[model samples]
Target: MSATVADEGTAPAGTRTEAVQALRVPVSRSYRFELVKLVSQWRIRLLMLVCWLVPGLFVAAVSLQSTLPTDTLFGRWMHASGWAGPLVVLGFAGSWALPLLTSVVAGDVFAAEDRLGTWRHLLVAVRSPRRIFAAKALAGLTVILAMVAGLVASSAVGGLLSVGDQPLVGLDGHPLASSDAAGHVLLAWLCVLAPTLALAGIGLLGSVVLGRSPIGLLLPALLAVAMQLAQMLPLPVALRLALPGYAFIAWNGLFAAPAQLGELLIAVAVSLAWAVAATVSAYLLFVRRDFTNATDDGLGRRALWVGLLPPVGLLALGFGAVAAAAPSTTGSGITQAKVERSVATSFAHLYRLQTEQLHRPAVTEAQLRTTATCDRSDGQVDPTGPGNDWRCVVTWHLPGAAAPGNAVYQLDVASDGRIEADGDGPKEVNGYFLVRSAHADAPNPLWQFDGDVELLPTSPKG
Candidate 1:
């Protein structure tokens, strides 16, 4: 039988009490209605299809490329296993893709009613505005979870079918057995859930306040991008943590053998906090709102300030909470081991790029026999925290040179994993580095200048 509240005058007192009690049940029919309405939409179906298809296609296409797309997390493993395909998409989606997909439904849930000129009629038909709000929120959450499921299934299945279930590779150059790697893939997807939920709440807020599709859809996604750019700035560490964007990539740690989760946990906390705050604020704004005409009334100066204040206030709360509760150090922090890895890996990668530019294919990090040892100026420094006075001595192969050459770098390593180095050597001459010696017929070795090289992070780019 259908579960619903009884009309006050129509039902006997006993029946009314029973109905009220029944209405307290966790899964309300009203919420089911909202889910049906949302999932049945044609665009939602198309989005699910795209979500399922894009990752598999991306993996297959990348497998054919001559070089890996090292800039993205799991990109290096496109050729590794079908299991890794899902993770690659997760990394790719960290920026705008995932947020935009999430916003597609969230941004539309409430504002869409305004767009259709049905807010008044819908509100009038529903007995309680609170119930309607609950239904809508539940429906959006359901869609987000469903989309994530589809992505996971499609990527996993499609990758397994296309590439086969091979062993997976970790970010630290270690390999995992296929059976064990499978669990981490699911966990990796779950890690992204925190940020995805946060974006949904932001979308719901945009819907409640703006009551317009464009603002509701684009604003939250744009804000997410802005948060990332904020992280890139040379701001204080606590300030960066306050913005939810910094934590989006914390899942990259899950792929590690032991799984470094301290940073990941902080990011999850901040993102969940944002999600709860945004959803609650959106609900409050929605219940208090006076729904008028779709085109003429609330679209203008009427709704702007009312709708704008909640999000701004929410951001302020996030910033303040992070400042007060989160540590001054947001990331893993700079360490000697990390510095050595970054310098060696980046130097190798940049050297490869340099050699490619010089038309030398034989030069590789392995053939170059690259090795590095790094130390902070203060020999007894803590393994973590920012340090400007880092030095790394590196030795590598240089063709036609009597012996291997060395580069001494005075490095400045930031907490965010960006490295800058000043070097004095034959390899790095006037900010230029040699890649290869001249062929038998040529006169001089080819070199790549500092401006020509890009310093990549030791961490995944997600």
Candidate 2:
């Protein structure tokens, strides 16, 4: 009896060791099997093909279009400098196509097994539901990553081949040197993928909760579109925090002058949160739910609502926040006028200094005038010599005041180079003049003119 008991104990130990060894093998083996099954599906193969071919087609179409002028919208959009090239394209795809593609794989991952009546067999043969869920999630994510990689690679390749290497101009009209811009474009594409992972998780959750292949595949895409539309509503600032769209806007950092890291970090965090929550919840629901009754509708209503609510609430809250934070337009127009006047006055002073130093003739009078409130002109004697001639005209608008009437001033310089300032204006108004140099294409050399001006009050009360 002792020998028989020892034999049984040894046998169980050996079996347990073998089980542990099997578990120790790389988890990827299970994922690989899932991947093989996924690739074999007709829908997946079609999606892969579409992802590759569509970008090529778009590149070809864009290449055929005539080159646009620098200022033209199409030119700016296609050029490297414009956000249109990489960030815009990637954002557009992430917001719509990536989610749709991920949903296709995730939605069908588990649901297809049920639809084909393979779930029962799968459960029996698969050792653990957790392991199966892990493998399936891995497979779905792998597919998404592959799709994103293909699209990014093809688009970059196509863009390079079609648009020869050129310094990309930035949104602020500054040129981004060729070498640096290329690196930024690549980085931007990678950052865009961060958000799509959450989209994959969302689709995965939908697949588990709905247990219907079609619902799983389409719901995430629909949800993305719905969120996008809802984010447009006038909402409070805090609510925007919940929007997926906000994550997308974070991509703007990649194109910023110094590169905005703060917003990008926030987006990365939010995206990861969405992915983890969706995936964990999906796993929990799948493990706890009964699969024994194949005839019973796959998911209960409660599970569906649980899966759907978080993202929906996030969307609504985001929309409300954005609307609330928008600027109120109480006195925007008046404020704008004041700001414009300040900028114009600064420009006038700078122009006057440059012309006086560069030109031979000295300015005699400078006159500033406005039709509605105040108008004035003035001239100054040439300190250097009597022969030098100088004259100027200045137009200005008061703070929070409408633009005044048209005012003109002319100057006559005598043979000796002395400027005799004579213009239609009061002596006090014409005492000092603002002078500006003539444009390169002007009719005469040393052309002088009055700078346009606006008088702004020193304080808001004025």
- What's every prediction's RMSD, in angstroms? 8.6, 15.3
lDDT of 1 by residue, 76-168 (tens): 566657786787777667787778877788988987777778767666556567888999998888888877887788778767877788987
Model 2 agreement with the true structure over 57-147: per-residue lDDT tens digits = 5654565465423222223346433323444457568667777887788777888877777777766556567778899999988888888
Looking at model 1, which ten-residue stretch has the lowest summed lDDT? 445-454
Q: What C-alpha lDDT does candidate 2 achieve relative to the native structure?
A: 0.55
What are the lDDT scores of the predictions, listed in order?
0.66, 0.55
Residue 163 CA displacement from its true place in model 2, Å: 1.2
Give the TM-score of each candidate.
0.70, 0.63
Q: How close is candidate 1 to the true structure, as a TM-score?
A: 0.70
What are the runs in model 2 whose C-alpha is more than 4 Å off? 1-26, 67-75, 79-84, 309-462
TM-score result, candidate 2: 0.63
